[model samples]
Target: MSFGIFQVPPPANEPVKSYAPGSPEKQALKAAIADMRSRTVDIPMYIGGEKIYTDKKHRLAPPHDHRHTLGYFSVGDKGHVEQAINAALGAKEMWAAMPWEHRAAIFLKAADLIAGPYRAKLNAATMLGQSKNVFQAEIDSACEIIDFLRFNVHFMQEIYRQQVASAPGIWNRLEHRPLEGFIFAVTPFNFTAIAGNLPTAPAMMGNTIVWKPAFTQIYSANVLMEVFREAGVPDGVINLIYVDGPEAGEVVFKHPDFAGLHFTGSTGVFRHLWQTIGNNLPIYKSYPRIVGETGGKDFVVAHKSADAKAVATALVRGAFEYQGQKCSAASRAYIPSNLWEEVKNYMIADLESMRMGGTEDFRNFINAVIDEKAFDKIAGYIEQAKKDAGVELVWGGNCDKSVGYFIQPTILKVEDNQYRTMVEEIFGPVLTVYVYQPELFEEVLELTDQTSPYALTGSIFAQDRYAIELASRKLQNAAGNFYINDKPTGAVVGQQPFGGARASGTNDKAGAIYNLLRWVSTRTIKETFVPPTDYRYPFMAEE
Candidate 1:
């Protein structure tokens, strides 16, 4: 599959002249290609409050067009991971001792830095490394990070100010305090927001953190470190390492000083880490906190009275945004039989209008997938779906790896709910459509529940208020973040807390006060105005 769309120009050393007004073709071309420049920077494993250059180098390539080399990043082994853990442990004492007000200031400063000088570069890297289009990359790399930082700063201040009341006759005061240990934050590659969460939440609550970012996003990750440093964050307060999975996990799980593990990834990996910690429980000094957000098979339901245009727009954006890599992206949709044809026509027409090309092309509605492995995995699923009985590929199953990992935006119609395509989480630009009679709405809901092991996010569209409310309550267990008249992707910072229940891992909602609470272990400090005169209390002395 080839597209003849206008290509985005390479980064220019000087600004180009804008097209004259009333030139439609010129304006269209300009709109189709975003004016963006890629900045080259050396990537290093950050440990012990410093960036460490290593002998091992991994060349970073843009997924949109593999010809563009983002930069060379240093790969860390077990030794580097250990250094990061040590740094985090070393910083724990002072960081935990710092006043909450001071820590909050540092985070606020970091937010400012990210929004200022680092904004453009981080946004560019996101576009280059992750194949996100201009607007999408900006949201993930710039907007989301700034929002998270601001939210964290505000939440920490609230946590700091919370107080306990004392009775009128009481002569003692109670205070809540910070935890005295290190946190291990393991983030994923899908969303740059995860990058912010892994460190900021812990730092907000006065806990030092050792962060191991996904290797696929080393450039943006390094930029994140630079932002933190510029914000006057103390040395060794947050340590970052760029390494492969197994070696990094081993270091994190085996460290004697490890206090908590904050993770977002696969269920298999989460279970493995849980078991690893359990196996080593006998030798550990104290119980370590484990928090995770894993896989999802999020769904959408369209009722008979649903607006066809609204449903189509929601479904297309939800399933194809960021190439459907988000855990909360809708993978399944149930449409009532009466509205099935209209919904299908509207969805197909909208998808046809979607332009697929490189990230630099502003007109490109969808970019490439992350890497070849993901490309192959999605391809295999598509091929398997085609071969299944009564499964029809409505839009796409095309793959072109000559340039990068690009898969066509795909839509499938599954005749039976029992089909594997309808059941599993296809974390790609693929949507499985299931048609159901109005009478079977309840049965369809049950099928949805049983089909997906994941319960991360789901949505319903209906004109009937009672039906919508009933569906919401009935499918309450279906999603940690449920939606009505909106897509599941693009969760706002303070509005909707994100995460899932069951096999989707812990429901630790990111970007909220609840998430910040997970990073710290609270200690209640009680002080008496008058010291006890004797060893025993007055009541005990009378006895």
Candidate 2:
């Protein structure tokens, strides 16, 4: 369709705005938050160019201030799921046939829109709805999402430029076509960038999508949809539906036109969806592409030669940021006996100085958990650790949900390396530390590798090169996004392509060309200049 090979505009990571005192960004975001809180808006499902609103409404409230209602989203059932699928399928032909340059332009424009006008609005929505502080919301909803949009366009162009080499008198061409049908994107509540990326990534490769954001993230998701519409994304290309998992899954998984699934959520849910897809393989027109990034019992291990202060800082920030709701958040740690004392003191001091309150307050380092269920689950772990003989409740185990779902940053020091808190994926601000003999560094690495079924993210802290190498070699398979002396979370879009294997879901690294390849089915064409008139070869004549 194009006369010449085209290059997409070069991409750069969006600069993260520091909402410091007296800053314009700070004032703008605060005004947006105030504006959003002043009124309760009605949200609708966007399907095939239509904003479908149903009678079944679900009220959305902030996790840090549960009583204050933000807005209400129209909840749909399985029928709406079917409608979303049909819409995606209906839009597939036109969307796919559009020139790739045009597609790239749309998303690039979307990035500009997000980086400019929609920045404050998106950040405010995330702060109010998902209870992320200003910085967390800025990095996630604004900067990260902007990076995803811009970088993905460049990746798409890179994919198309990849072609097979042709010999003399013949032309070889490679065509990267979109999936046969449509993609179904199921995103989690923890990340706004991820929610936007899941659907748009596939759509950028010319596929249509039915996107289902987490119910708790609907407030911010609606803002993303607004951005998409403003950026000129055609109707039915990416349909947004608000529906429960089971009802949506039953219809989506069973549909023959379901081309692929791009997901981010729990390990359990990913497994269930994979099983359903496998069982329904016979009904599908083609083998559906399954891609997911799931749960993690992420870890932070410090060697005897590691700096105590640095290790403490990593644990405090990596484990407690965003209330430890991130899948890559550090949940467990193994500290050498010689360094445990100093690390403990530093961690305790940091926790003591931290404040816990709503997201509006900039001084509060810790906020409430996502919802009542998450709060209770985290609280249950803290309460159980208090009673367990193998673990000691070292710092911050107070759980008071009277006003909001607030649980203090809790820590458990365990004698047993395989203690419940150490092994389980508690998606909250609960960290379990186990002290090991200084000589047993290698042994502790082995234990860490085998303790958790997840292999999402983990870090090793060591000033000694030999110790770092040893841990890296020993725990090679323990994490997909392994760190040397840094925190496991805060993966940038283009720099660190994220995802993990084992119980953490498929390791098809997102934020890279590798992920874009999944949404496309390539076709190689060989055109010969000269025709073969004879049926027999030269060897036949010799015979």
Candidate 3:
């Protein structure tokens, strides 16, 4: 490979195919899904390039059709977790010592693999494993994963180019060194792009990783591992494991060499992990780095002058896509009373028009939620809203888990901004609406800011520039990913760096240099060109 020292091509959002009727991409996806459904794969724990199988085999099934077996994965215990950790440590020296250019090359190849050869299979796996429809699967598993891989290379090059200033007699330079120990990356089932990014980001910067993906996301994660191996990521550099969270934590966190954590999961789990690390802080060789992106109760707000149809579309797409599992999905909305009637009409029509069913059919706009637990949790909230006099059901509020876990896209109309549904992070196809007096726009903005502890993402729709400007200024720290005249979900890689402050996460801003910086530590080097034999200062010489 003739790789040259160069700047990366500017990143642009990956074009999304409509996957409309009779489209080639659509056909390809259907074929892929059918192909995956026809066979049951045997997945093994990958430690140091070794495929370790276990007697504790767990069957894999689609969330949309839980009765059918798609595959089986070997479940690991504490011993396997320890083996993964040891493997990561074993590969650390050579992987970290390799030239930066070589590291960049490997990931770059992986991106190409995802974009070209592995595209349909990975997308199909996401649909079957996570219950996402075709379009949702395309954006996440195919496009977003490619974006992360390519953009990370650019970010890595950018990080390397940063040099320190030099004084008159000496040249000063700074080295961005990878952290000394292995990273424990715990990813969620929501996004396959995140599953690939969390561990690969650190490895791209010369760090080793013990990656434990959510059991639900493992089908696609296994595909990602294949891409990585084909791209020449060395043995033991990024060991993939399938172990229980607490069991793995018992071994990894207590180990003396655990250097960092890359996590994107529930806030409760992140907090517990943080506390565990704190309690075991003295056992490690150094303070372990904790970079986590937890839960979010994101929102959307509309001004009185906003277009009703546009606002309605944003709500439908933002709150219902992937069944509102996105961390940046709009869960709550504050609408002006003047526009509520028209907006509500459009929203209801859209919900009524949407089709919900299995992922094998591309025409269905809505698919089942991840599993039975998610279905029950969401159904409980909908049932509460139906029973409560204070809340009115605007549209769908039904759930059935007989064949698959299906929760209808539900809308709850609330008079108060402080309603429990408005403040809580319900990762489901649920949207709560609070219509405020147009005159109380300022108050509503304040209420929206105070409604949730999370500040991940939010949107504002307004034809009035002054109102838009006001909300932007008034709700400054309210959201890390803020949108204007757009839905809050679907943050692009390079354009809208994703993360949040407060309870949402560390706000390191993934998809940019900020996130990559977290994986590295800095060292300053000063080279004196002409060493003075005497260490005396000018004043001392004069004396």
Candidate 4:
């Protein structure tokens, strides 16, 4: 057998199609959801290609209607985590030694599977499990996942092709080598795309992974496992476990083979892991790479000359989509006092028009929050705002938890920019607004920049060119993903390269080349054209 020089095709974002009523795509997805909901799926831990069923099981239910049971996934403890870690280590050498082209082909095949046959299945899983509407599922589980796989493969190729410069007498070749040991991927419940990407991104670079998905997202995670197996990813290359945070960390952090952690979840969890790793540094063989994308207190600031209608629309879509569970979801806003009345009315009109219910109904634009805990936390804030004289509940102060974890799209009107609602990350469909004097644009811009500890995503709306320029320069470090005249939420792959800094995460920029760099260590190979048989040089002889 012989090999040819490899070339990667240009990467492009997957086109998102609307699953509107009476459309064939809508019919197919509805059918998929029906089929999935009709049966109770039983999920087990996958270690070294073996399906291990634990004695303990946890029931899975949709957040929209919590009483109905959709499936059950096996509950794992410390022992299962150990088994998963060992499995990843067992497969490390072979996977790392495999030809780079073969490794790339596996994820490419998975991308094709997601784009075609598995599209409806995964999208339906996300809708039922995560309470996302039809469009949300399409863009998240289907389109974004496809883009991650394809673009990551292209990114891996780019890393591999990068070479060190060579002198005349020596040929220097650079090799991008995978980490020496296994990686741990702790993914969040919001995006099924992130769930898939967090693990597969490092695996695409030939490193083995022990993946632990958020309990709320196991339904969709199981579908990804099937896709990977169907696409022929080798056994033990990427192991899936169902252990919780502490259980997984106890086993993974203590192991000498722990080489990296790819995380996308709460900031608290990532920081705890960092602290644990730091305290136990002496036991590990190498300093593990910690890459995490965490919580965000995202914002949108509008200048006096900004278009009222456009600003209102941005707030509606950016803050309410996916029930405002996204890390990049806009939770705070700053508007000049002059335009506040008009913008507030425009926002209220949109909020009143939104219909909230189960994602099975395409007419419903908003769905429930993930689970009971998230529901209670958001409800508490709305209740507090109702009582506090410093703040007023402008819209959506209602919440009902009898059938599902549902909260209306709420907006809080506050006089203080330093209010708790403006500074904290609610991670729900709650937007806190601070109306400022139009003349204090610069001062309010600085206040908005300094309000939150997180610097994830932010936006500005302005018709004045100089004002826009001033905000842009002043708020440079305020967000990793900044938007002008657009919402910060719908970041596309290859185009936006999503991530953020300080408290939000490491800001490696997922779906791009920078993220792939964290997974591999480079080695330089130098070959001398002429061998120096003699030991001494001219300078040494003269000396």
Candidate 4 lDDT over 449-522, as tens digits, reads 88888999999999999999999998899999999998889999999999999899999999899999999988
For each candidate, C-alpha RMSD in Å?
A: 8.7, 0.9, 1.6, 1.2
Each model's lDDT comes to: 0.78, 0.93, 0.91, 0.92
Give each model a TM-score. Answer: 0.91, 0.99, 0.98, 0.98
Candidate 1 residue spans exceeding 4 A from truth: 1-40, 168-176, 532-543
Off by over 4 Å in 3: 1-10
The model with the greatest lDDT is 2
TM-score of 3: 0.98
Q: How should the candidates be ordered by lDDT, best one leading?
A: 2, 4, 3, 1
**lDDT per residue, candidate 2, 311-332, as tens digits?**
9999999999999999999999
Which ranges in model 4 have alpha carbons more than 4 Å from their true place? 539-543
TM-score quality measure for candidate 2: 0.99
Model 1 residue 370 distance off true place after TM-score fit, in angstroms: 0.1
Worst 10 residues of 4 by lDDT: 1-10
Q: On a 0 to 1 TM-score scale, where does candidate 1 land against the true structure?
A: 0.91
- After superposing candidate 2 on the true structure, give the runs of residues whose Cα lies further than 4 Å from its correct spot: none
Whichever of 2 and 3 has more lDDT, that candidate is: 2
Candidate 1 has which clashing residue pairs, if any? none
Model 3 weakest lDDT span, ten residues long: 1-10
